[model samples]
Target chain A: MIRSLAELKAQAKELGPRRCVVAAAADPVTLQALSSAQKEGIAKGVLCGPADKISQAASKAGVSLDGFEIKDCPDEEAAIVAVEEVRASGDFLLKGHLPTSSFLGAVLDKEKGLRTGRVLSHIAILEPASLGRLLLVSDGGMNIAPDLVTKLDIINNAIEVAHSLGIEKPKVALLAAVEAVNPKMAETLAWAQITQMAARKQIAGALVDGPLALDLAVSEEAVKIKGVKSDVAGKADVLIVHDIAVGNIFAKGLIYLGGAKACGIVAGAARPVVMLSRADDAETKLNSIALGAVASVV
Target chain B: MIRSLAELKAQAKELGPRRCVVAAAADPVTLQALSSAQKEGIAKGVLCGPADKISQAASKAGVSLDGFEIKDCPDEEAAIVAVEEVRASGDFLLKGHLPTSSFLGAVLDKEKGLRTGRVLSHIAILEPASLGRLLLVSDGGMNIAPDLVTKLDIINNAIEVAHSLGIEKPKVALLAAVEAVNPKMAETLAWAQITQMAARKQIAGALVDGPLALDLAVSEEAVKIKGVKSDVAGKADVLIVHDIAVGNIFAKGLIYLGGAKACGIVAGAARPVVMLSRADDAETKLNSIALGAVASVV
Candidate 1:
């Protein structure tokens, strides 16, 4: 199991550099992050944007664009070309300097898009300084309010990421406010149904339980004190939140309040898509690129 | 502003004792707790239960029954008598060794109950070792799944408690998973509506904002980093949750995970009701009783 981001970065180094196609890669911070990842030998990407401007931005960020492919294209055409690069032969896709809508549209394009007929979801990996393992939180960046089927797909996407990272079995806790399936709390009801479904082998490769409170999902002492009984009571590797708001808030809470390091990627696509927050520190962005390298294989 | 449970205890000492009626007070722990309060001059109460048994239990618990009123009623009638005691005296009510359902039934009785046509809600006060002031979380124990109106009442009930606690303008944060009023997230929508209500002075005596994630409610650094602008951001005294599950889980999370000391009481009744959990430590229970004393006047 990958315990820390340090270990995750080590794993990415072992996986070596991948052909990471950067969609509209003109943003200075994005170019700098990609340059750092390239220097670390975890990734070598094709920057699909106006080449001269990309170089200028890279120069402004004090990063060299040497030893990297620069595809000369405008922003709108660059996104399509980068998506095609990843769809044709590259290992992963990285959205850079493009409007989120434009980038996502190019990836979701019907005929030329990198679609695998699965609902795409974002997975955030947080490594708390104290917790010995990485905590995976999902759908925080996509799918505003997913239904049962969509939630199932979201869980599957996370499980696949776990599998890609070499976890044979990841304990997934579907987070609600509580563990009981109360008639009034819809998250509990949904978790109960999904837990039953996972029990019946509908969602495989992960040990799933819920609707667990945040403490019950993460703290061993809470399980004993609350007298809660479950396989994934306090040792959850992944927390599948009910909706995008919950997922986003929870991931940010852990980062901002808990002082944890975080990285994020979009899953359920044909390839891993590196997507880091704009204000994220360099280590976080590099770890995201490392995650992209690791999740690129599957 | 109450800084700590110890401070709350000191405040209770300064307020002097009020008439507090305990229903079915034959249980040893209940009598012991009440006896200690009585000794501190923070409570004067009628123990409504069988006399001889109550005396025996009190003796076993090393508590004296001197200088107090005792109603010789069986378990079934003890709850009713206790409710009537509060109704007639207009003081506070405390649940003793009686079953929760029975005690609550008596409080909700149509003709003789302590109901004031307002929905009863539980308010949990947490004073973290690090926080400068108390955090109030409401409706965790009562109102399983409240509607928008019930939520508004819950907020009002919390506001009433804040007013009694001498907070002229308490900052209230209606907690959701995110700060945005996203149409897809129902919790955010509800918080937005209630926030507008608070803004319109429909719910007075509080500076209200939402939907705020937990981090934004308590952490000033998070507010600055997120660049969120609101009156209740980063300095909330009261947190009005979406439903019972959210409130209960959050309070427990702070207690079990964040190492916060918590005390809870039932508010929005004719008289404040002490309803601490049985597993609560003695100090927490006493603080809850103190909270009941403070909120009873409002």
Candidate 2:
């Protein structure tokens, strides 16, 4: 199994030099990250945007695009062209230098989008400084307040990503404020329902448990202290939250406060979609590209 | 200002040996922590439980009750007796080994409780390993899903605690999944309303901003990258989450994964109420007592 980001990058390098098609790839940071990924043999870049803008971005970032393939397109048509290119032959898609709504608009386009009949969710893979293994937090960036069906899709997407990382059967923990199902807390009730469904094989390919507090979901000491009996307690591979706020804050807390290294990608699409944030560091962008390369292979 | 947990403990010791009344003070961990705090001159404990159980717990934990004042009472009456004692003479109240509901029942009792005409909220004071200063997170363990008015009270309560910790004009950040006030996300709308309310002096004693993501709330780098113009963007003294799930997960994530030192107490009562979890370490328990001692002074 890929235990850390280092191992993940190494695995991606071994399996790759996969084609990563970038939509509106005229951002200096994106050029720099893709250039580094290409140099490391993780992915080969197919930069899709206006040729002049791509060249300007590469020069500004001090990056060499000798081994890259450039596709010239107008600013408004960049996302559509990139999506069509990926659907025709390219491996995965990456967003760069564009509004999120515009880029997502192209991806969700009815006739020419990467639709898989499943709800699209964002998965963040984190290598917390305190934990030896990689942890996955789901739907933090994509789903605002996911309902029960959407949460199921989010879990499935996370499990798929874990499988690509070589985890045979990921343990999924549904996180809430407390372990027990409180009548007033609606999330707890939803989690309890999901847990029951998982037990009955309605959710397959993972050991799923629910209504766990953050501590019990990740800490063995907390599990023992609380006397919680669950397969996922203290050893969860994926944490599924009810809403975007919880997942986003939880994942970002680990990264900003815990010194965790993180990379994120959107799943449930026909192809892996790497969405880079301007605030993300260079290392995170490269790691995300590597994650996309690996997730695309399967 | 107290920048770290060590500094917090020192300040507590300097101002204290304040009287702390313990409800159901028969838990081994509680006895041990209180003994250490007493020795450190943080608090003078008044153990309010059956003398026999207290003695047994102290001996089991290798603690001495030499300087502690024992108030022998049945388990059922321990919380009420402790509340009454604190109302009469003690500086603060500590929950030792009782169910949280029972202990809070006494604190929230209409006639005999420590009512201050404000909604009670739990504030977790964290000394994150990555940050040099203390960060306060509110309503994580008390209010489940608070409305706009309750959130205002929660923010006010946190501001009071920040003041007690010597932070003048604390900067409060209302946390959300994103910085923009999207109409689709109800929490973001509420946060925007709260921000406006703070601007109008409806919520006083702090500089408050809303709809900030976790990174933008704490990281100057994120603020610089996003170009967010706000006083509380990068220097938030207090983080106000929308619900218990978000606050709980965020705080515990920092503690378990970020290696933060935390101690929590319920604010808005007449006296600070220290509520330590069983899973907390010895140092955390002691720090909580110290926090109670300091927060009780004002």
Candidate 3:
């Protein structure tokens, strides 16, 4: 029932400070975001890149690195070091300037990684101006073309995040273009299977239903107009997309065109991960940290 | 380019009148629409249904049956008779009170109906007040699970409709959830293939590109923000959907939630087909007829 990003931010504050370890923390924007998170008392972080470069970035961004600890490693080794640090402390793994693939590779390393027998899926939570609720879209950044099992993992990952955000029973919409199970559309078939699975208590911690269009999933007026009867209709917490493309485009579209703000994280690990795109504005960056910090508590 | 639905109506007016055959035209909304279209000189229709019932319905809706030619047949026989009438004239086929399944059965009838070599697809044209252009979405009503070949036909149909609206070289954005062609997401792969096909002149008569998200397809600012460079990135005339659901949901969302007016027609037929749902308002009904009128000129 946290309807707005402002409410989410306040809740993150209520959760107090969680620690974050940033890979390739020499990036000025990342340092600025971490600094802002620290200032807001949502998260504190260990910068795991070259100390000199980190210092320079902090200075460049007009941030004080005084109280913050720098692990002092070669920049290329930062992701590896950061992953181990986060794994040891159970703190959040925040990505900085490192390529996501390199950062994630270390995190997914079988021996010294943060795998929790679940898929590492990306979740972007949007607070659309009109929707008046946090809408979670998953795997837009990870798991390019997931099979049915991978999709189940993606849903579970998002549900965990939604639960952390205090949505006790998240309404997960397995979004397709429509609500019917058509043989031609693979996503609808998947949704039909998933819906039954949820009904049978297979996919727990969420009430999932779909093959819902964007409107039917979010707008009450549309639900009435279309006369679709469902508890999730006009009220969905998470939109489990058909694939990476659908989730990616939808997340980007809401942010860019629909006048919405978003926070993104990689879930299904031992701890939550923050990997805000550099293209994301400062507010989005800060929001990601708050979301990561709050979720890391669980 | 014809940007508004008003412009679409004017164009239909300029094309004069196209003969439309209405199956099961005994419904009040049906005859009302046909009567208004005749009054506006947009269409002259053959109403194939029980003459008495059609007249009564017309009177109830305050419409005159003076101009439109009526075929005195039982309501059950109307769909058959109307299909034959539209087929012979090679004009528009308007659905009245008939079940869509029955109407489509006649249209898809191999021996007698109006089956073009191409697949029959439904296109919804929206003149969003904010976007300021007619945006086309296909297969929302017809085509449950169209394969790549059927999708191609759908695109071609939409392009033809775009042409009728004065867009010479329509920018067709094969809309998926994301821009990246992830191996797992079938729609993205289809888009990538279609984009290459367009580049190779395999699919001509339009500049097609994809795996575009909604924002990148329609917003110039989003294109620059995301650093995606494509001719179809900012301005798209048509959005070729993954299947019926994407088109259905997106269109309904924009209209119900985003405050947009829409006109829908089924294309890729020998003649255009208009099937306004009972949920559709009066203006939408008239707009559909206008769009069909203009498209039928070809």
**Interface RMSD of the predictions, in order shown?**
3.9, 0.7, 3.6
lDDT of 2 by residue, B1-298 (tens): 7778898899999996999999999989888888999999999999999999999999999998899999999999999999999999999999999899999999989999999989999999998886889999987998999998899889999999999999989999999999999999999999999999888888878999999999999999989999999999989989999999999999999898888889988899999999888888989999999999999977
Q: Candidate 3 chain B: worst 10 consecutive residues by lDDT?
A: B249-258
* Error in Å for residue A290 of model 3: 2.4
Estimate the TM-score for candidate 1.
Answer: 0.86
Best by lDDT: 2
Q: What is the TM-score of chain B in candidate 2?
A: 0.98
Q: Which candidate is the best by DockQ?
A: 2
Candidate 2, residue B157: lDDT: 93
Model 1: lDDT equals 0.83
**How does residue B203 of candidate 2 score in lDDT?**
83
- DockQ of each model vs. true complex: 0.30, 0.89, 0.37
RMSD (Å) of each candidate, 1 decimal: 3.6, 1.3, 3.1
For chain B alone, what TM-score does every candidate structure achieve against the true structure?
0.97, 0.98, 0.96
TM-score of chain A of each: 0.97, 0.98, 0.96
Which of candidates 1 and 3 is the stronger one according to DockQ?
3
